[model samples]
Target chain A: MSHEPRDNPAQHREQREPEELHTPIGWPLLVVFLGIIAWGAFYYFHDLLSATGATSEAGDRRSVVVVDPTAKADGAAVYAGNCAACHQATGMGLPGAFPPLAGSEWVLASKDIPIQILLHGMSGPITVKGSLYAGVMPAFAQLEDAEIAAVLTHVRKSWGNAAAEITADDIASGRKAFADKSTPWSEAELKDKVGAP
Target chain B: MSLSIAFLLAMTFLISVGGLALLVWALANDQFGMGQQAAETIFAPGEVGEVEDPATPSAARAVMQNARKAAHQASDSEELFERTIADQSSRMPVLFWLSSSMVWLLLGSVFGVIASIKLHLPDWLVQEAVLTFGRIRPAHLNVVAYGWASMAGVGVGLWLIPRLFKTALVGGHYAIAGGLIWNAGLIFGTAAILAGLSDGLEWLEFPWQTDIALVIGGALAAVPLILTLIKKRVGHLYVSAWYLIAALVWFPMLFVTANIPNLFVGVDQAMLNWWFAHNVLGLWMTPLGLAAAYYFIPKIIGKPIRSYGLSLIGFWALALFYSQVGLHHLIGGPVPTWAVTISIVHSVMMVIPVIAVAVNHHMTMLGSFRLMLYSPTLRFVVLGAMMYTFASVQGSMEALRSVNTITHFTHYTVAHAHMGLYGFLSFVLFGSVYFILPRLLDWEWPHAWAISLHFWLVFVGWGIYFWPLTLGGWLQGLAMLDPARSFMESVS
Candidate 1:
């Protein structure tokens, strides 16, 4: 096979190093070139504006808003999002800082006392499960009545604590009762109002 | 901020003026005067369209040359040249570098297979800390990238530059020394990695001390190539020479800058790491692969490239676009939005050079498709050329924000990377090695069937390796994107 090129001189001319012809680039290539450039330039500016937060909700353009008109507020999810960081997912609060919500008389004792505490918040050293916890619990007054009620109800039933479910009506009444109290409440003040739980 | 703006303006002015000055100088010197005649410079007297192989008798070639000389006197200075002098000079260093690279290639593949197995069976190699998946994976990456791929690229360049320049390699001894030094560095680096003494960077796992060794070795290797280019007998520089020179220039700068200790931190480090990593492919491996493709494809088929002008555009555009496209890997990361956006844009713009290259190779090989059956070099090289187009286009797609949002941080990205590096770069390297070794060793392949066997094994193995993984990775990306799925479910 290798000898055939040599056997016939006209069959195979001597091979040379690769060369390039002077052919012109066609129109399809030109179209692709122009199209990519235009698209790239447009995408850069458009996505850059949104990515830099130049518009509302532009940080994540894929964040779709799902407005569920008939949806119920999930208390477990609310707990995970808001309270689980300090209280823990197991409802077991930190040893000395955060008070435990599970199997605690403060949460299961009286529904109104817990509601008042949630609405006004508490700062002074409070007793939970016979231990003193001095950390402050922030006011959840911003949460809807149903959200607050649902969260309290969730805490009551979890972690071996059996208690009646709190209703939105109960939370609404608690809000009305504490409407004038603008500041966080002391433990003593709460105990006095609730008749020493 | 205002000072930076003024500096940038000054730079812009300087570049424009410099470019204009170069154009004027080029025109005055009649740089483009060679015209169509310049393309013929690669061929020696009576060299075009002739079948010259290592196995072919020199007496026959001399006879053919005399016949051609008698028929037409194209140039008065044209004379019969002996390629034996250059081939003999290149024999030692090229063989040494290529053989060492093959050793590393085997070792790297072993490490890669181990890592892949560990992904499926965690307990398979857990007895030794050195063999742990974390250590094994980086070792695989670094060994293949720095040892196998880089060494092979340099080896090819060392042999090719001399061939293209039509000169004996001036400092072949230095290249041999460089190969030894390079292997020593790889040994230390891979050992250090297994022993948990890594730098903790992705592509830069080797410690700074080892990096210095690599830099020195690379410089030593580059000396012969530069000397050969300087001592070139040919007046016209081929397209392959251009790409090889650019690769040699770009790689050291990237390696040195990226390895500087404590220069970058946090997001800047990430950007630098990716920039260096991606350029290792784009500037280093891609150029080497393309150079081989440009040379071997036409050399095998006995034809010139389709478009000279398109080749120029391809080379310059690749330099312009590939340098900036690295930052696209950090899209949606904490880096500045504008920085990533610019990278994405450059990545998309890569289509210009890619298309230019694609057209040049495709159209050159258009009528010569049948030659692939007779030439094993053509088969692998053509596949490599095709994959270069496919991988680069897919890379452009992957850089888009819409595509990246799903594919980023997924196995899909891994598959794409393999497509570029192994599919495109490694295949080209394989083809080049096959073509080069025979010439260097002065031996024809003992069996044609063995070559076919090797080609099919690699080709079929690659298909089995790539397709299922690509499909699985895409599905994995989709599963991961959905918030409704649990982690276990997504992975499973």
Candidate 2:
């Protein structure tokens, strides 16, 4: 074999394999990079830690039922002010931009489901009326528990979707569930999960 | 759409596809494993006296002294020995890619000028379907930003990165594939917009399908670059490589997240839209231009960078400050006062990175100012580096709430955008192109006049676009701002 090493003795050849090489700062930077990445991952998923709300124990209307008419009324007005922008005033939507709030299972289910959905946000492929709606719902977790409660109550009643009326207590309960967590919900992971308060 | 518009769109797609396919063919054939040890070989005597009937070495020296033209033809140049992908890649391919980019840029510029004037002369180009300012304006942007600038950046990056690292490209095929996919996205997106099917979000205006295509292309281009860097034999990572890689990561993330229906929902849309729009400038295009500045300034002067530490400062500060500062775009919007406050804070705090880069570039060229006259690379790089400072200051000034109220929806915004995109980024790209094209192609520019014409066309034309006209338009908007008068009456 013609052993004509073009320039200097290469460390690559001396090491015999590419895997033997290392970044100059070695594992520390790689570790720091990993740490940064891990922190980012934790931040992305932090919502799961603080996730809480209604506790459903089958056939219990208390969990899924609306007790206060005033709570429902307040929720409706709040929903009109906030949620109305995307879902639209008529509960329809701007077609592809925002999904309809009317008759949405995510919006109408147990108060726990909508509460969590509102707080931390939900993402991915969802089915409403047999049509798969892929949308990103931003977290309204920043809003007061009462505001979230009122908005959910409003969406449930005002829209053609009439389910359980959401009370502030229901939402407040949900807030205690994931007090320390706040990552946006990934659609695939939470697709089959229960609804929030 | 008119036949010409249709034809232009189709031609753009065809050119992008062909260019991509050519790169893929070259990569698969190991064309990228060219004479990457250029730096090592650059110092050699070359093939001057090494021909079959060798000319005397002294005779070769004398030949070199008299006229470079004769010496260039007579000397069996190092080009005679070069035959890698770098060699086979050829000048025509590079020029073909570059000229296509420039063509798109010119088209975009013409459309933009019309759009600017059409604020007052809505009847001028509003008569036609495709020629409407709404359609033509975006078509212009697609051509210049995506078609011209991005394509040219990739072309130069592909050629330069591998050469600098003295490495054979392992994933160049993926880059080619990505380039085609990206171009397809641009064409489809531009066409959809021109068809009045735009999503109507400023900068996030493209439809979903186009968005997906662009992200995929970004991944393809990024994969090869990441691979090349990993396999590189270089001892130290250059500042230029850092900027190029950072852009690759930034562009894809912005494109994917911005267009995803699930991520940017409702109220978040306004916030996310500005985030993506600014990054496309700060993260995507700025990095490409900055990389050129880092490379050309030092390379032209034949010295190490003035301070590698400043380069590091510039890179990280940009990452930290630019991302946080996007909220400034929501200045007058109802998106919360805190967000606006943070954006303005970071926008002004942007001085750190800009100054770092200025120090590095200016100090490096401290004694080399004389070379600006002799070297085209130095002139363009200095021009771009200085413009970077100017644009960043203006960007900060514009982000202030009081200033934004006067300029936000006016032509001043357009002028600020032109200053950053064209004034800063385009000039840097031009310098990089001048420096790399000759090295990549083994042949001198066949027609220097054409290249000079291209530069003058861009620089001189921008004066007309931005200087007095854009400023006057903004002042006129401010005059129309008094609360006592009707909107129409004030404007009139």
Candidate 3:
């Protein structure tokens, strides 16, 4: 059958007789396929070996350092992990629940106040910047003295509150003093023991 | 902070000014002067051993001269036809790339189906960690994006660029090598991801070890087209060629820039990730798809595009605007407000190019509507073009803060994404395959019924896939906004 000639010159030129070229599955493709297979095998085995190696290394390392838990705590890191959720990253804590540590009289007063709070926990209505916040601050008693000191130091120094650094020795003393207190302390009890802000 | 801001502003200013200067230099140098002659070169009569015209002094003499000229023209046509046939036949590399893409498409579909099913029945494939939903979802995305879309796009470019340049493809071996290496990379990358070795970045999940293969593969694949462009017979760069070349250039840069590990940290890393992710759609897939649509729509209909000026506007505007628009993905996130605002502004500016392309395509298809019923190529191409306009405009709207407030973290974004990737890009690729395969293989498709059935099934399926998700997402957003609505209620 004869086809009609196209009006456009480019279209007319494009209407060419069909010709097929025989392109067999060549050697390059085969070589590449083999190469891929080899690479995949290597990658899979390497990943498995490395994963096992890491776990074994971790296991070997853990046994030696099981009892020594005096690792230096990064103040910023401790605050981000433990304190940021309720007090907030800016230290402008949630209204009517968690009190803001930023420029709070209690935070700036003394290192012993925060050290006691970290080791023993705190509860009841606490007035900060004229707003009363009543919430339970869980005792991070499981944390090492160094971590407790670091977090207390972080909160005091942060959010425009200028205060003295809290040391691990101070945290140790605070924990020793609060050893018999099983329950969280009220605002009045904390103030009475640590001195009024 | 102020100093850094000033430095950034200066850098932006310098880049813009430098780009403008280069454009001006090109314009003044007459680089684009031979438009009409270049456009006609592809169709000009082939050489017939330099046949000389005899001076016609009488009627008989004129008739004899005319007859001789006709004989020469006919032989020239025959020679041109043979050359074209040889050109079409020499595309084995493209076929290789396309065939590999098909395999990936099937693989991706399997992953997608499994992932979708797991959403409802999580325990179905819970035995193996590799077959988990988290692994399967990324694998599906990677297979579709890199394996199917990218490979198929390269295949089309390899064929289309040479045709536009009116030259035989130069580096067939390079393209084949690239395709093979690319497939190897995909195999390794997907395996790694399934084995829980993912880098944990969306769209950039391929482990660094395997990603290097993709970079090398992409560079190799791009060589042939770059060679074709350098050796082009015509002076005028067609709009399709502009898009094709830009895409080839943009992709490697985007890929390399995004994959540089430890170069950015924290919020900066998120910014770069979104930048790379969005541009993969905008700069890479969108350009290739649009280029195919632009070339096929006019070529099939036997007409030039409606407006050359509009095509240029669309191409340049897209290049300029689309780059900055990716930051809109991080709206309301930790990134600077100025960056997000700039992205939103650029996203809206995208409408300029979208409309330009829309008008050009719309006017071209205005008188050729009847062809869609008869031509499968036209049917898919036209529909894809329309969807491109729709999806891009919807994307611009979604980038707006008002609309984004509702659409963020909702299934509406997912629906929008499918509309762009599947409805626009994939549909265009399907049309391109249908149009190109016959020419490349020198054989007509075996079944018209099958083609029609495939089209309907996908078309209806896509409609079903997109609409409910879009509506449900909007409802979900509204429910989320209302304090009275519970999370469970909204989810249900």
Candidate 4:
């Protein structure tokens, strides 16, 4: 610690000059910071304008899109990057090793089961885009609430399937039910639950 | 526009030009002469005191005075430095504390709110010139980055550099003038934006009229610093000074280069515009803020940096690498390949400095974990430095061709920006403000609850805000790469 500079213990001791408070405040810094605040207000309004620029896409279209939240690119990316690697991009997964997404009725036919299947992925024989594919689809329960919702949405939207959106809130509800990712889903486990559609 | 309105607008532009002239004049004079000596001579008046004492006119006296003047100048150069420790006992505690932290905390909080809400509800409010996300986002950023952080950073820098170097502020006049211009510009610029007249670029959103006044204010602010350095007693030239000086140089360049509107005639605006804006975050603000953390943390705790050479490499590399960091952003854009290639290369090079600075900061805090138990400054700064490391790694990753494939222009970049600026730079500055407030004000902060409240609101708000963006960005990035996807399909 030879290069170490020693602190004077006396320096740490307190003093009481309630009067030296007028140590010339900096004008330039104030201007810079304040300038930024004003600058931000400009964008607040500008962003408002940019938002309005696309009036058609704001409200109604969003609802239709949200209905298939997996349609969310972020959500879908998670699905494709992680899930699709095995689910065989088509969802008509490999007969035994992976499941096919193409025309799988399970994805289109149900809402509640998909959430369950997504949260605690199916390992035993399960139905996907259609035919009974017996493969272990890893549980994504450990994924972030948003990720879980997104993957479920992607599967629902892709491969000629149709279903309601899987929102973040729905995933949160599933999280409350199962916090860990170890459990695998059976068809019976998802046989009765109903998603908000 | 009416003649009167036109006149007012013209006057604003005039003010900008006028300030730039003053800045250039000061800079030019500095090149030819040791102009900074004027402030030091004012305070010490060493030889001038005795030389002028014999008021009688005599050549012999004048020659004798010259010899003494040279000696005094030589001696003054070898300073017995003091860390400009404020008689921390000063009582104007409220004004000092409030000006530095309270003002910015409030400003930052407001912008934080808007930033979060704007994400989900881009069209939640009126779609006027004054209320667009584009205008408001930059305005919010400038306020947080400039309005709040810069004020507080300079306030702390004003006090701390002197202390660390064992010196005091030399010119109150310059400091005071700078303060006025800075505040007036901020108020006017913020108001103008609220009124819906913004230039509509990131950080450079402040229209030319107000920006000019702020630059004038900045030069005035810098005077005391130039004066203090000349008066500095230490030869050690601590690492913090390096960080600060880099910031001072970088900010003006960012503003001058970015604000040169004629350069952005029509089509090539975005390419040039983003270059300036992104670099400001990379070079100007972050360096100053991080430099403060490096100086204060160990200065207070009583330790040497884990590696001095590493600190040097980090600082110099940051200066070099940061200048070309924005190009990775436009990797897939129509900007020339060379531009994108250099930026991406520097962005990757950015990793070296980031790690070096982080190691210097975080490792120094390793044994001083006990300080975090009692010192709020250490806690905030440590957190900020940690964030600096986090965000930087993410930046390099995003710069990579492969990784950018998944993160570019998505919520991921948004999150990274926040993590770097707000998470690292802003967080550290907040701590610096809190620490300096007590030292300058003489009394301890009256409202710890308020302080805690401020920190929590910012922390939680930021987490809630940035996390979603990263997740969403990743998905968006994936969708963009899918060739089958159209614009509507990608966002959808």
Candidate 5:
């Protein structure tokens, strides 16, 4: 029996049973586990605390319930949702990439000029506050007249711009005035239609 | 829906509390006192410190021979019985499961490549409704996930259990029948998906009727494994056996629990979808891969695992952490803040298991790294093990709110999914198959170089496949985030 080889398949003891080295779970793992737990508990409670303070129980009903078209649009909310991405929430847009809406001559020119610019998007080079900006601003034609007017009113009131508030009636008239315009307007094209301020 | 979230949250909380209680009990009772003695459980009488693999030197083999012969003085009849059990268990069922799984793998890969190609060239296969990207994509996913990956897992798992128990498979016929039914169900389900009769959920594209087949088939397959465990000749179960047995139970439970008809609706349905989808990877595929790695890595290299305690930590932490991670898939979705937050934390907590497993495997393989050069199984399994660490840690990071916000809808997610499922799980399965097939069939792999070629091709191919998509997807996410970039620009 002592002479028999351990490699034969027919033998029940052909292979050794798998063993384990006597390594201990050292302090590093303990530290990591405790650290993660502490962080998780902190994060969880922090989220709950901040969420409670910041949000009402109503809690983002924008998606859950249907909006009433007759309800007055919140100008600031509209601006935050649509325009704030490009034109900063501060209304001071990205330098070179986007033009600032804060105290812009184009925005404060005539109410008609800003309304037309928004209804039909701008392309090619356009100057805002003496800086030349070349980019595309997508048309907000899909927006309701009230939403368009509300966002425009928001920009006008914000960022030290003392322009008068634009009404939904102004947006409606602007849409009708440029109903045939399918393509975006260039800076030259906009100047040709409504003279520069 | 809130009820569902509350239920899941409570369940996670209960598991954490229960785990903590168990830890306290262990500490109080000194359960972890005998770390060295616990590590010795895997060794039989004279097997301790014995190198029993083919790579062992002739002098070492002689020493092993003397030790084993002295320790295990079995009679001639006992040896015959052992041989008989080994030969009998490696019969019809394993072959059927493995061969069919290979066939499905080939088919699934073809479908996947076609779907991928169509993403760039939409008009390429648009003529056939079945070949359109929408139909083909889900078809590919379902086929690979259920038909190929699951079947391979069952085959290898079934084969390993009998060996671990030192007994013949208790109900081999049931596994065969189950394999047939499972294949039939997969075929019907895939055809139905191509014919536009899908359920329209990501992993649940197979209709309810087909899901019934899957549940029944899975139950049938599990019978033999459970019975084998019950009828075992071995006194103590190994860590690998634990993983395999747990998987057999976990998969069936997950499949049945998630597949109950009309069980969830609207937001709850989305939650359930991700829960099941993620757990399929976590509980089902992951256990099988880890079990294979735990067994083969030590067996091939002629070494014990690094630490028995770490293995226990890895297993328990995985159970407690992984189950909660499903909700991380809904991180930025319409789910409750607390629920997603818990999931994110759990996802991060997964680092515990990943690190534990990593240390054990790495330390075990420390001196035997050169074995990968000669053993195809070692190469594939080791790479898979390493990727498990990589994929898991990456997944943990990806679950963070800050990271998920960018990568959620992008191809980055797709790349990450493949790293885990394909690079980790599939590679492990491939290695297991390489090792198991030769033993089961009583024949060596005809071409070792061919196996090496296959490895390199996949290794290189996966690198080519993964990096671009990950980088491109990250850039895509960035572009989508930037207000200056157009929608079409991001698409391009």
Candidate 6:
């Protein structure tokens, strides 16, 4: 044992354990932790309990609604689920691939032109806001007439664009007009038939 | 789902409150007031008795007595305790756990290498489902985090805690059993993961059945440590003991809470997943690494810490702030904005403890820069401490919305993780192993060249692994943000 201690210098060095200082300052630190928890709880419950009707900055871009209150809410929901991915929540669509619904001449032109586009999709080169976009817009003819009306109404009134609300009657008329159309409409065909705004 | 969320929140609340209450009790009882006496306890002769020598001449005996008295007045108890602790137990269980940790480290490294190769060569292992990137990646993560880092930490803790508490290990057999069971669990869990029977959660990828084995194994292994703590000869709980014990307690609670079958669903499951994942690092691995650094740095340097107060702040702040910061992983995700916001706030608050730890360590090593040259342990530990500070500050910044916007889905996050787990935690653990092995095994390292080689290889290897990923990943993120750049352009 003596030889062992002699061989290992590390073992012979004295351990210097620090004196455990008495510090009363830890209470305030604990308070900070508690405060954070309280704030988190408050925030969580506030988010959960509060209704979605609060007019947020996000909602400001899509405020126009002259339809039934239920229809407006349904339209917002429909837009969020179906159209927001490519066209974006603000309807300020992707730069090259998707065309913007916000401030689009086609959306604000007339109910028939937009309704026609919704019933029979559009394709090929098209100009939106002075940019040439060659993209395919899929048809939403499978949507209920009321749903089509609500969503179109949402797009038309949103993003500072004011237009008359498209109704179920208008969607029904557009569907009837494009009943025989199976494939997407070409830009030339859309312009020839529906006419540019 | 809501009930589980409430349960998790309640658990966090209870832990915070319980910890605070312990502090309050300690304060009110003046447990900290007898610092000098408590510091001297390790040196004081135990009730077991000491041998007396009466054969010496009067003059020689007088000189010897005076020398003994002078030595008692100084801080020589550390040396006495060291010898006592080393000689008390067989130290076989610690060796067993450490050996198991090394095995896992090698296994994990193999998995990690395979996983990394598959990243660039996706078709290399496409033939077998077991070898697919998805399975191998999770296995690598689990093995390294739970299998390597954790086992190594526990092994080190088993050896270190008793020495700190100045008590003989009470449950050596139980600890060995625990180590075996833990390894068994890891083996089965890794196999199950490879078989694609995963639970589909990050860090909790082990199915519930496998988790049971781990939970049991961990509990068994913790028995001796807890017992040692209970029968501690010292009055004051050292900072290292606080970290080690808290980690032991925190881990089982975290493991059980996060892995309960079908306890949460949808986004709530996601929330709990991140909560568990982040805390496993913050609470478990981080504490172990920090605890090692706290112990070895001072022990090797043979000095008291600069500020015990800062150490307490560091420990408590880590406990409180680290628990909630996990939700920052889900920023810009489907989870609620409020949850993400709170997580961000908590993540930023991590700076308090990081700085506390940094200042304490920095001030302790203020004039001892030359120790890094001669002491292999100091070199590794000091590097680890520096990396810890760097990794944590980077983590805080990364949690911010501005930085996360670019770095969120990039390899930058991966680089950051490696910096933490491998660079910081693993490095510290390595230092601990180097320092402890000699004492436990009663042998010096066979070759100093090997250690030097290891230090350079790992240090350089980490630099190579980390910098490219960070810079390249940042560039990739920038490219991804631009609509004009093709996805392939960013990837390639």
Candidate number achieving the greatest DockQ relative to the actual structure: 1
Cα displacement (angstroms), candidate 6, residue B277, comes to 0.2
- Candidate 3 CAPRI assessment class: incorrect
Superposed Cα deviation of residue B218, candidate 5 (Å): 0.7
Model 4 misplaced stretches (Cα beyond 4 Å):
A1-11, A14-197, B1-101, B127-129, B266-268, B446-457, B483-492
Worst 10 residues of 6 chain B by lDDT: B47-56
Q: Compared with the true structure, what per-residue lDDT tens digits does model 3 show for residues B102-162?
A: 9999999899999988967879998999999999999999999999999898888887876
Q: How well is each residue in B189-235 modelled by candidate 5, as lDDT tens digits?
A: 99999999999988989988998888888888899988888988776
What's candidate 6's DockQ score?
A: 0.08
What's the TM for model 1?
Answer: 0.74
Stretches off by above 4 angstroms in model 5 are: A1-14, A56-197, B1-21, B24-44, B48-84
Per-residue error for B490 in candidate 2, Å, reads 6.1
> What is the CAPRI rating of model 4's predicted complex?
incorrect
Residue A2 in candidate 3, Cα distance off native in Å? 27
Per-residue lDDT over A51-166 for candidate 1, one digit per residue giving the tens place of the 0 to 100 score: 45343322554557897866767789878878899999999899899989888888887899889878888897888889998988898889988888888888888998789999
Clashing pairs in 1: A13-B49, A13-B50, A14-B48, A14-B49, A14-B50, A15-B50
lDDT scores of the candidates, listed in order? 0.78, 0.64, 0.75, 0.61, 0.79, 0.78
Which segments of candidate 1 are over 4 A away from where they belong?
A: A1-14, A48-197, B1-31, B49-80
- Candidate 4 C-alpha lDDT tens digits along B311-397: 654676676557766766776675544456556655765665676677666666675666553455566788788888898888877
Give lDDT: candidate 1, residue A56: 30
Q: Which candidate ranks first by lDDT, i.e. highest?
A: 5
Q: Candidate 2's residue-wise lDDT over B421-461, tens digit each?
A: 88888888887676555444444455545665766787787
Poorest 10 consecutive residues by lDDT, candidate 1 chain B:
B73-82
Displacement of the residue A69 alpha carbon in candidate 3, Å: 34
TM-score between candidate 1 chain A and the true chain A? 0.66
Tens digit of lDDT per residue, candidate 6, span B73-106? 4434445554556434627888998899999999
Mind giving the per-residue lDDT tens digits that candidate 4 earns over A141-195?
6677777777777777777777778888887876676665466866665564433
lDDT (C-alpha) at residue B456 in model 5: 90
